[model samples]
Target: MSLLVEMRGIEKRFPGVHALRSVRFDLKPGEVHALMGENGAGKSTLMKILSGNYQRDGGEIFFEGKPVAPDSPRAATDLGIGIIHQELSLMNDLTAAQNVFIGREPRKSFGRLDEPALNRQTADIFSSMNLKLDPKAQVDTLTIAKQQMVEIAKALSYKSRVLIMDEPTAALNDAEIAELFVIIRKLRSEGVGIIYISHKMDEIKRIADRVTVMRDGEYVDTVDAESTPLSRIISMMVGREVSEKPLDVPDTRGNEVALEVRNLKRGREIRDVSFTVRRGEILGFAGLMGAGRTEVARAVFGADPRDDGEILVHGKPVSIHSPSDAVRSGIGYLSEDRKRFGLATGMNVRANIALASLDRFTSKAGVLDERGMRETANNYIDQLGIRTPSDTQEVRLLSGGNQQKVVVAKWLLRDCDILFFDEPTRGIDVGAKSEIYKLLEELAAQGRAIIVISSELPEVMRLSHRIAVMCEGRLTGILPGGAETTQEQIMELATQRESAMAPVGEVA
Candidate 1:
């Protein structure tokens, strides 16, 4: 089998950060090569270099054993390289066909956009992939899964032989993932090489033929996907033996209820949901995608308005029309999409940590306490073991795990007794995940009521003292968490519709 793509001695550097070291990688025709690494381990950077989104400071790239230099994305595309970023770059307001051929749309007489020809070409490409998307459909109206199919269509339209997918399944559901795998297998059988980048161990196991691990911008090792244990791949990526201890589920019946919701409702996205979180307890919210776990959290935290519901803090009904009101009532929410909702990425850690409680740090004369902010930021930086040059470092420069910790620090500074972490460790490495697990446990030990919303069943079972399952925005059931719990039990409730719903406090 001949090599489809090869990269050697790849190096990239930013102002003060050495983003990549002497990294090397290769891909064979008709193979799925998985790229595994922690955030900031330089996997994306290397891919960008290969896809010509960024130029390598020093390296050599070859295509079909011929030396090539792709200095721009268009150049790479011309050479049959296509990259689908983690954040989809499609223009949502445009039609699917328009988005697929943004720059190189077919032209009619006098160079006018040939709309019919464009749609016809797009339909042809979609049909070739056995896809069911409408070329004339609005991108905004499509689901994330469908939008991804459009990205793949765009790639195939370029006649790309090598497709690079970064965290492709991050926003997709189980059914959507299965559909994507079918497309991947079809492409593989057709002799297309795929570069698969993801943090999900199970996904790589299911789809990859070979696995390459990178650590802190350097190539660690590449192993056979079928022959290597996940534990070994994880250790190679993190350079350590990461261990997991069984969660100790304590009896919290005697604990004080910190927060409670009765009949939370928000259109069809969220139904009449009700639940309670006791002090010193972790309540895991489990559900499938769009099952309304995050909706329940946002509703309670005042991030989204609920049509009818009562939120009580320590037995007193609280009026939370906005996030400020929720914060005043001692509630903090760490959103799943942290970059968009949780952190001020462009700002420094000190500024973000003090963001939720800036009023508390201001003097009567209206002066800001810079020194106090620094002290507080440094305090949490040390406590949380955040890897940063200083408290003044920009949050965007930090890895995904460290950025998440910064969000955790912000909530901690607000002194919120009730914290909701939605998809808390998504996109983080296994090492960082273990740390986050430890942090959540410690917070619970300190008598904080924590609500964790996660799509991963094992994470919910491992972290929560109790699991609350939702289906179509309704609370289907709640179960005790720990070794006694099975994923099957959660899934049963997760898919249970309103017709099969048992009232809250009524599920045995």
Candidate 2:
């Protein structure tokens, strides 16, 4: 049978970035091909070329054994290629149905939008996918997970022969992901070619028939998904055999308390939470969903109104009534939802990096130092290993992992004394994750107090010098972090009640 899609020696270049070089990929008629790579690996760039969003500098593309060049996104769509991008690209003010059918929305006799037909068609698509979402719901009102599903539905609406999904499951929960897998299986049965891009190894094992790994800007190898060991694939993507090692925590017992929370209260969401994070430490916040780990972060950062609490920085009480105040007090927060809170997606990398410390880049006369800002951004881009053509690239153009790095750079540039990283590595690849881990440790070594909230116990165990577990909006326990601190201990603490708090550790 002829290959559904094939690319040979795919070469692409930006102004200062050689994104893809001799990259090769092929999709079968009815198989899930998983594309695995770290940030800046050119996975998205290659796919974008396929989807006709960008013109390939050099490559040979064969669709059904016929050589053809797709010049634009519409051209690719006409050829039955649909892509759900890594980032959400929906019109906020439009209805779910409107966003799904966007430019090609159904029209009536008078050239009016056929709202009823649109809603009905969208509803049918959602129903077929077992997605119980209202088609009339506003795009801005929907949750991130739901918005992601809409993106999926929009792609599926194209009835494409080839479907490319980039991190489709990044924003989805376990149940939503399972539903998506079912949909994938159905499409595979229908002889549709599926190109799945994600950093999640487990998903590759579960849904992919073949796995292709990319590193830097080159193709490594493609192998049977079930047969190959994940470690081998990871090694190919990272150019090293990554191993799981226990965290080595230095003794921070004598360090001065950098931030202290005394009886932090925010109604029932946060109940008298008391904890102290010291300078030169990585304090891990571990808890299950709805356990108030993020709530504490929000309350402390002044994003959420706290009914009562005493916040102390460097052993002195500080008044923090807003996020601006928190920043003024030398605190930086990296939210879990980077798209909504951490970044201005439409802005350039240099502008976003200089967002937090604008004063540092401006003269007293209010003149913006463009050259100085550019230099500072470039320095951090190199230092943080942020993948971009240049500092002038729009943040929305970068991969999810790269965007997360930009958010970190913003805070790092601000030179905050206390940092809050909420779910820092969610949706990021293993290679980028390792870099973020290293950056956190480096910040701690520089005497910056860090609070890292992560649901992954292994990650918590790996990065923390001390672990604080939360349960039902309260601090349940604080354990010493190391190889000796097991996931079982953290799990127990995560489910414990406030009334049953252990006396082994002093929280304040």
Candidate 3:
């Protein structure tokens, strides 16, 4: 394979922050390079410079043996370089075709939007990629997995020779991830150089040819993916030998029941969902996509309406019609899409942390308690190990892991006893994931009941005291979450659905 891109001595900086320190990376034609690092390890910064999202403070970039400087995203695209961000950038209201060809839409002679032409073009791209999607369908109506495919189609439409993908499978299930792997292999076979960044070690070993590790804003080492051990790679990234710590399943049966749902029915998405979570316990919800794990969590949290159900906090039935009601009943929900539902990206960390409990910080004269808010925010930042310059820093400026921590802080500040964490470590780095797991364990030990919903079987098995499996909107089974629980057992329960039950409404 020929050299496609060579970035040497790349350097980047922000006000009072040295983001990247003389990092180096190289890519070859028909190769997938996995970038491994902790959350502030400069992997994203390096990719941003390459994609022209940010200019490099210092570096030499060579493409096809020629020096080139891409000052804008358009310039990068024109130069056959494209990036698919961790967060999907599609417009919710627009059709897939419209979003794929947004800035350069075809126009009729009279200056009208050439809708048919755009749709046909998008259709062709999808067809070539073996992606089954309607070009005219609205993006918001599509599933997260489908939307991810559309993002790949849009990036490929740019005729990209080099592609950068960040945490592409964070939201995908096992089957969806397999499909994406097929697409990635197809792209690689076509001689497209790919820079793949993900925290999943199995994925890196399966998809990447070369592995690069970065630590503390500096390059650590690079090795062949097939040769280096996953443990060694993780150690290089975190500068410490990191191993999976067994979850301590404490005796919580004697503890009081924190939250209990009985016969939770929400128009088929949640059917007869009944469960009990005790204080000082971690309950894991495991299932495939459309299996209704998230729906159950949402119904319990009062983010969505429940058709027929009874909720009990501390063995006392309570009415919960909205999120505020759930909060008042000592419940908090950290949504899977944190940027959309969990945090206000435009606001500062302190403000977002105190958002849910603003009433407690308000004075009798309607005055805001700035000092109290800051103190609480700083306390959680220190406690949770959230990486931020200050409490006043914008939430959007933090990395994915830090953003998740901020959400955790918000719910903790609100003093919720029963917390629903949907995909808690999604899009977070491996090191940061370990930290989050430790924090969750600490929370459980502190007598806060936690229900974690995740698509990753290993994660569910590692974190829960008891595992609850859902299949097709029904509670298939529950198993002990320790050594006895295997992935095969979870898969069996995940696909076990009752044929007698009527089909429920569709979920996007």
Query: What tens-digit string does per-residue lDDT give for candidate 3 at 1-508?
Result: 5589999999999998899999999999999999989888989989999999999999899998899899999999999998999889999999999999888899999989999999999999999888989999999999888899999889999999999999999888778899999999999999999999999989988999999999989999999999999889989988998788777778888999999899999887888888899999999999888999999988887788989989999999999999999999989999999999999999999999999999989999999999999999999999999888899999988988899989989999888999999999988878888888998999999999999999889999999999988998998888887887899988888887696433422111
Higher-lDDT candidate among 2 and 3? Answer: 3
- Which residue pairs collide, candidate 2? none
Candidate 2 vs candidate 3: the TM-score winner is 3
Cα lDDT for residue 238, candidate 1: 90
* Candidate 1 residue 174 C-alpha distance from true site, Å: 0.4
Worst window of 10 by summed lDDT in candidate 2 = 499-508
In terms of TM-score, how similar is model 3 to the real structure? 0.95
Predict model 2's lDDT versus the native. 0.89
Assess candidate 2 and give its TM-score to the true structure. Answer: 0.88
Q: TM-score: which candidate is best?
A: 1
Q: Give the poorly placed runs of model 2, Cα more than 4 Å off.
A: 107-115, 267-269, 337-354, 368-409, 492-508
**Local distance difference test scores for all models:** 0.92, 0.89, 0.90
Worst 10 residues of 1 by lDDT: 499-508
Regions of model 1 farther than 4 Å from truth: 502-508
